[model samples]
Target: MAFNFFKKKDKDTSKKQDRYKELTVKEVIKATKDAIVIEFEKPDWEFTYTAGQFITLITDIEGESVRRAYSLCTSPLVDEYPAVSVKRVENGKMSNFLNDNTKAGDTFKVLEPMGKFTTEVDAEKKRHLIMFAGGSGITPMMGISKSILHAENDSIISLIYANRNLESVIFKKELDDLQDKFEGRMHIIHVLDDAPLNWQGESGLLNEEMLKKIFDRIPSWGHENTQYLMCGPEGMMKNVEQMLESLSIPKDNVYKESFVQGTIDKAQKETTEGSGQDYEVTVLFDDEEHVFTVPADKSILETALDKDIDLPFSCQSGLCTACRGKLLSGTMHLDEDEGLSDSEREEGYVLTCVGHPTSPGVKIQIG
Candidate 1:
């Protein structure tokens, strides 16, 4: 037997995850009636971020500790306070609090930035970047589009943004500024679900025909120079994928990231594909241990939440490593792994947001 001693950098325990630091709110801008942009002063700690990474905000709300992740709408390439846009979600605890209660001069702790929905941009490469953003999914795309436009001189960005109507569009004014700043280099196409009279832009949901028309704008797709970045509803993302398959485009050309609904299943919410039997696991996080009875179909994070365990988590879709832990001893299955690197798996690290223990007595160290 051969042992691979080449340790992965990402799995190295020495690299401590950045702790949450107090960030002073500089200002708050109401992007729309339902969405607001909060800007924060950068802390003293060394913080550097890519285009699409997210910041995890921890707040003490109504006698309960709540944490939620929001993508940075500010670009790292641009010197500004780290900013994130919050759109009001129906019955969303954190979203409502952020939208209705948060204000300038307030202080909150934000975890270090982490996310994998990013790409490397080369200034010399002349490529066409196409992005699809729906609702709040436009957050990260804003940073990415700005970064690409500012850093990558030769690359062009085409953004197809979807909204319920003109009033519901997030970052409407900022996007318009980008259009003016980039002129011919950046092109934006607004796709509204509810359009006003004499509406000329696209109005229907994303389908094969709509996707074909969107791709038709670019002279060369399914080739080496075009890269697709999609973030939005799962149905729309899949529609684009299906269209790509039909066009025989290489899978590598398209990149996508989606938001998962919640860290755990809520009351009466049924999930699919599990043994339906209760499985036991012990989780250790931040020097505290808690035992949870996780249904085979539910993820460990979900189980923790149901049991009222406060676990540090962001982006329940496994795209953020906040819920990652070491699998000390367990037989678990991981369904989504884009956030984790290949080397991290070899080092026994698993994203608990998407990990399920198959049997009882699984031990996980989440600290």
Candidate 2:
């Protein structure tokens, strides 16, 4: 009788403990002209993400809500105050809200950090870390650069940050101060895309000639030991990638992010406009299924939400892949997606934000 009573007590305790797991909540922390930073706090949530992971931020609109994702700029070391910076984009619903409304102490919803951009710094190897970032996309690279400088004092880091002008550069003062502190250990070159001719730094755009000129001062670090992280506008990144390839840089050592949300939005609009057809989607969760007819004017995600079906999602632009679902049946067309890789798409996963059903029985499993 005593043994049975003890076993029952243990089971009850375990059940109660499971119920006490902390839930995720959004908290507004800071607001600035170019950006706003939100901090998330959950007791049970412990993010073991590396230096370059990104997270999605979801906001509830008055009638219809939209989501956006930002690369986390703050270090993972801060257990109590993990945060990310989001720059406001012109005509963007979420970015405008983040810029105009969010305040410190206000709450917001965010998904867990997810990304593969990372570094493997070893004391045995004399690795040189080179980072290139443009405008607000500097968030993740900032975290990585700071982490490298903080961890290994001897490691060399050369960063070239491009912006419209001096006032628009994020973390400008901080980077300048860091340069003063680190001296030769870290180097920063600011490139202005649009500036007065009096601009004392490099101008126009980053290209092979500028990259070669900058690196000419430093020794020729072999491609095997050097790592490059590039984050910026799609055009800038693509140009830099081509230049690096022409320079015989290793493909595996280069990293880039699909942060171009505006392009994805344009592609989505174009696809829907050109399709000229409407279809229905059947979503299955648990044992129950829900069906809804979608219009060509709206995305599948929007249609599902309009029908009052709660679906898990972040970054409605299809950049975060938070709304990825398996295509159990039926054919679908996608606009533009940078979230899922080739493998995920080959396995029949689709980003619902920009996806539309082409067949009648477009079924997807949901939770």
TM-score: which candidate is best?
1
Residue-wise lDDT of candidate 2 within 17-91, one digit each (tens)? 332222243676443457666665643556556677777666677676566767877665523556677888888
lDDT by residue for model 1 over 1-367, one digit each (tens)? 1111222333332223445567789899999999999998877787788989888988988999788889999888874778999998889899999999889899887777887788886778788888888899999999898889988888888898888898999988888999999998889999998899999988988777898998787656337888888888777777878988898877778788777543345332333334576777888765556676777678888878776666678777777788999988867877677667767889999988888887667889987
User: What TM-score would each prediction reach against the true structure?
Assistant: 0.81, 0.75
Off by over 4 Å in 2: 1-33, 36-48, 60-64, 78-80, 118-126, 152-155, 180-183, 194-200, 207-212, 215-219, 262-298, 328-330, 359-367
Taken over the whole model, the C-alpha lDDT of each candidate is 0.80, 0.71
User: lDDT winner among the candidates?
Assistant: 1
